[model samples]
Target chain A: MSLDPQIAEKLLSEMRRGAIVLAVLGQLQREHYGYSLRKNLVDRGLHVEEGTLYPLIRRLEKQGLLTSEWREEDKRRKRFYRLSTDGREIYAQLMHDWQLLNTSIQKTTGRSE
Target chain B: MEIVDSYLIEIGQHLPEDSRQDILAELKVTLEEEIGDRAAQAGVEPDVQHAQAVLQRFGHPLKVASEYRPVRYLIGPDLYPAFLHTLRVLLTIAAVGVVVVSLVAAFAEGWQVGVWSLIDVGVSLLFWILVVTTGVFVAIEYSGERLGWYESWQPRRLASGSLGIIDRGDVMTNLVTEGVFLLWWNNVLVLPNVINGDSGSFVFNLGQVWAAYFWPFNVLVGACFVLHLYVLMKGVWQRPSLVLEIACNTALVAVLIVLVTSPEIVVVANETAGDQSEFLTNLVDRTLRISLLVISGFCVWDMWSAWRHFKGASWRRSSAA
Candidate 1:
């Protein structure tokens, strides 16, 4: 039987939320403004909504995982963001955990390389 | 630019006051970039339509703003069930109390008057109690989860909140008993005929010990009345409410202990034959002693029951987080 779309969407979003932080953090290793960051992630096949991305950025900043500053770019003011020292350490740990979990899942599903 | 500015303002209005300007500035820059991108892709100016399209893609302003705010939980999932149960229990007690009062009034007046009173009293009492209960739960919710005992045993994990509801029938019995006692205690129901002889000289009267303890009894009985009303609605025993039950029971038992130990709990003032008066005094004293002792025993049992209800409640998660 097919799963209901709403239920399926909810489950999918929960999984996506788990990975969204990693995706955002990985991109934030290089300094990029908010708009450019969104575009860059979208180009890389990770589509995050404008609304969802801002709060995450602010939360990460508040948690001391990101640092941001406003500066003039292309004749207009823009807020650029990048990872702080703590963010780099956290991102590295998370990447290691993800890889291990991914490997286990692959083996369990008989899709191991 | 005007369209984007207006859109940003609209979104900003719904956001938190502290972060409004910072968030709005970021939003504006992002929207401008998005509109510019769309305009370039289609070979057009970054106009109103482009801004509109970008805004639509972002979704509703309120919802977007909401994502940034701390999640609003007046009574979060943790206490929502108990809140609802408490509300239902209180409403039920109010309705029952109203019906009883209205029925008594109806016998004296008319059926229409009784029905009107039932509706009026039921509506007003329910409304006030609902407000009071909701306010209390809201306070508890915002009270920052400081209750060590509340979460000590995984209250939220219990799918069906251990209402520790002994039974609905038992609650009704307690509710009715408390209602009658409150009326009798307040002198709304004169029991002089039952306790006194035809001459009105006291055959059986409460001793001097009760003079100081009147309001204490009212307060304790009222506390238990509310507790039972809550228990009836909850249908299971939870921690904080059960703690209240235990407290009320202990206080009641304490008062009963004092009353039973008193030398003259019920002074028979009849100056008839010495033997008869003495016999009457002994009978009344024995009866009072026995009754209070029995009630004290029940109170102890209630305290034990309240404790046992959640004694086995274990921590479902290692970390509450």
Candidate 2:
């Protein structure tokens, strides 16, 4: 059965949001500019666009989870973003939470026998 | 070729600003390549009309363009929260800036005089420039590209810049002039007393400080020249202003003016008064005088340069407007 476009859009949007949160937490430990971060995410199998990357970087910086500075690279300038101390702590916790959830779901399905 | 090219251009019109060219190029190639595939798949003659219809049925040009692009959000899940947070910080800073300005004016000098001082003039000029520039860019970027609040408005030709001309000689000459003028201003008018000092080193000395005090006009003239050079280099003839560039230049101009011209030098010197050593008083006086001269010169130069550089540029009216 084909799904309605509206329902498909909503479901895909939620999935995308969850993916972004995970992707951001994973790569932000080291500094990366928006373009580099997008490339990194794409390399890791998470396709992201320039629009999404920049605003996300800004948001993360504003939230005290990231810090950024303008740095010279290849004789051009780029703004590099890195995880803050609090961000590192939060990211670790988030990973732990994700693992626990994944294990619990697997066990519940395994027990359905 | 002419008929095929027009068809391709029509499809190009619907693509987003950032990826329009790339997508168009890819589509053109795909059409050329896919013509063979379609002819083979259906076993038809190399009919251009059939190929065109097949491409059309695969999707509308805009829809196909969207599919090729990776998913993006302007005010996406990642950025909206941060944006709201930034808004709070900016509002707080503005409030604090206003209170500080008022307090400084009330306590330092007559309110009316303070209101009309050169410092006040610089601050107001900077404030309006930032507000107006940001507003205009935001409005233009959004409307021109049909971008949503959080969508990226990447222009198609960002790599080469938006200008039609590619004359390197003109740009190089401007930069050389700018750098030379900057070095001259710092070395000469601002440090006259250093040459006059006992050791004759390029550093500051007694006769230099007195000379600096005597030649306040030189400070403004030198500063004006340096500032013009910087404006020519940074704004008029260089790369376009990205978002980060705009933020930095705005903040730098505002902070520099406030720090340089507040008569804070006099205040600091006065605080060091009542010391027993007459030599200390002289040192404080000299330091304040020299610093004020340097700062005033720099400010005047920047203001003059910004005005002059922008006035002469092709985009002068648009930028100023």
Candidate 3:
């Protein structure tokens, strides 16, 4: 069945919203500032909007899942962020849950490999 | 450079003061970096146009600043439904009050002047109702104190389904009527053509009785307005609102009694009339008395009904417990 363009777009957005948190947490294992982190995500095929990415980073930092610091590099100051201990623990738990769900879905669809 | 500085300044205007400097500093660096990248990709040195393009891509200053700030509202979601309810109630009251006033004026005078007065009063009531209701809600939202009533809400009350939901339409009608009446009482509205005679135009003005207790009259109306708003906000009629309603109704009843008993509660004067003046004055006086009686009846009914609702709520709470 053909999906409406609006419906397809909505579905894509909803799917991306769920995945983006995991993608952000995974990428934040190493230190990267807002702009560069956005670039890394885009290069890895997740084209997160700058507006969306920046706000999410700030929210995560506020939730104590990430720690940020300001440093000067190449004549410019940027706020770099990385996974805190809590964030690392959360990332592991989320990954495990994701794998279990993935396996369940695959088995139900008879697409297990 | 100046364009970037101006852009930062624009964003800074919307941001909260404590974090404005830090957010702007970070945004400035990011925008400049984006401009540089755009310049390299386009094979040209970055200029004001490039900076502008980057800022445009970043989005409007308000939108950008809003994302940085925690979500805020003039009337947040928790109170929005109540605000809407209160607004509807007030508007309905204004409409009914305007219709009644128009009919009375039309009966006393000519239909032409009455129709014009109706339109004028209707428009003014609507405008003031909107302004006052919005102002009240904005004040409540900004107060930021989650009122004790909200905090004390019990799940059993919801489950019991016995909570008195104030009739949305009645509440709205009362609020608007009270608001419009307050405006009229305060001399914000003066109807010159409400009463007319063969000799000349006559104006029906509130007599010295109301003028004597002017501040108290305002306080009574103001209290009623606040009580209606509180009920509408709470959604379920709570004990505190009931107490306030009864108090305001009692005050209104007293005021109405004093007004009706007082000599010449409404005075009518014609600019060019001689013998016909007494007839017009008596007519106006009788009309004022009748209006006061009708309002007084409503006040007593309101007080009785509020008392019943308050008692019913308490009984329900006890039963549920």
Candidate 4:
């Protein structure tokens, strides 16, 4: 059965909100400026709102989970972000926990490999 | 370029002064890159239309600026209960204080003042009180520091003892009634036509005794109102509030004692055909004495209760230590 469009949108939003932090952290493993990072994420089938992504990037940098520096690129200034040491440590732990939870959920739902 | 400048200006208006320039520069660069990328895909040079489209997709200036700004509140959740408690207490005292002042003014001046004028005074008092209370809470919220005194508190500290919880409803009722009595006592509201007996018409007036003690009486009531506000903000019957309460109640009791012992505080001015009778005068004197006694008794009870709470709070602190 097809889901109601509003309900589908709401569900998608809720799902995206939970994973966005993890997804952003994963992408920042390599250095990328704001515009390029957004394009890369969209190419990978995770469409982040520009308003949402910019703030998240700034917050992560503030928390010391990401490090950013402004550099000249194509004759324009661009702030590029990359995962810090703390970010890598946190990402590894979060990924491990997420994998365990996913496996357990799959087993409980009788969809185990 | 004009549209971009205006858009940036709009966003800058919403942003904090410290970070406005830096944030705007970053936003401008990102917008330009997006516009250029879009133009490249459409096989045209970036133009005003492309800039507008990119800015549109980015969202409204307020929405964009809000994302950068931290969430803020006038009174956050942590202080909300205390704020609400303080508001109720202030409103209650204001309601009572205005009424008392109005009644006293009315009686001293005469009962010629209209009801609407008295109501306007009461409303204006309440509005000012609300504004003052909100301003205080906003100041506390922005300070962004939790009260240092409460840092040592833990739920487990009260495990072996029972702390007195304030009943908001009961306190509110008491405050409202006190406010009304204050208005009545002050002569802000006057009973113009209380009785229309067969022999004569009776009007209410302040007795000669009220004029001599009016300032002292008002000062005592005002102190009590301030103490209640302090207690509301503290959200508990702390030592300071309890001590203030005791002092205020003692003053009130002393004043009531003087009023009751003296001959009369309420006078009935009869505007009728017949002369005023001795019996009616005696009755009015007796009623005033009885009312004073009741109020004094309430004050004594309040003092006793405050003393008990003061001791209890001290005991808990000692034991917790």
B88-161 per-residue lDDT for model 1 (tens digits): 66767675575456446545664333235434655788789988998898998898753344557775655365
* Residue A95 shift from truth in candidate 1, angstroms: 2.4
lDDT tens readout by residue for model 4, A1-113: 87689998899899888588898899999999988999999999999999999988988888899998999999999889999999999999988988998899999999999
Candidate 1 docking band: medium
lDDT of candidate 3 vs native? 0.79
The fnat scores of all predictions, in order, read 0.77, 0.00, 0.55, 0.86
* DockQ score of each predicted structure, in the order shown: 0.66, 0.01, 0.53, 0.66
lDDT of 1 by residue, A1-113 (tens): 88689998899899999799999999999998988888889999989888898888999999999999999999999999999999999999999999999999999999997
In the range A84-113, model 3's lDDT, one tens digit per residue, is 999999999999998998899999999999
3 or 4, greater by DockQ: 4
Give the TM-score between model 1's chain B and the true chain B: 0.48
B1-321 in candidate 2: lDDT tens per residue? Answer: 344467567666765687566445534543554465567778876577766764665455555545545465544444445444444344334433443454355446523322235346446755765565456445544454433544654766244432223233443343333333333333321222322223222222333223343334334333333443343333233334222223333443554345445442322222222333344445655666666566456445434443444445547547768
Please give the clash total of every predicted structure, in order. Answer: 7, 10, 3, 16
Tens digit of per-residue lDDT, candidate 4, span B212-237: 77788667776675666555544566
For every model in order, the TM-score on chain A comes to: 0.96, 0.86, 0.93, 0.89
Q: Please state the error at residue B38 of candidate 3 in Å.
A: 4.3
Residue lDDT tens for model 3, B198-234: 7666666677666678789777887887678666655
Model 3 segments more than 4 A misplaced: A1-11, A89-113, B1-3, B38-53, B93-113, B118-125, B145-321
Check candidate 1 and list the clashing pairs.
B162-B236, B162-B237, B163-B236, B163-B237, B164-B236, B164-B237, B165-B236
RMSD of 3: 12.1
DockQ pick, better of 2 and 4: 4
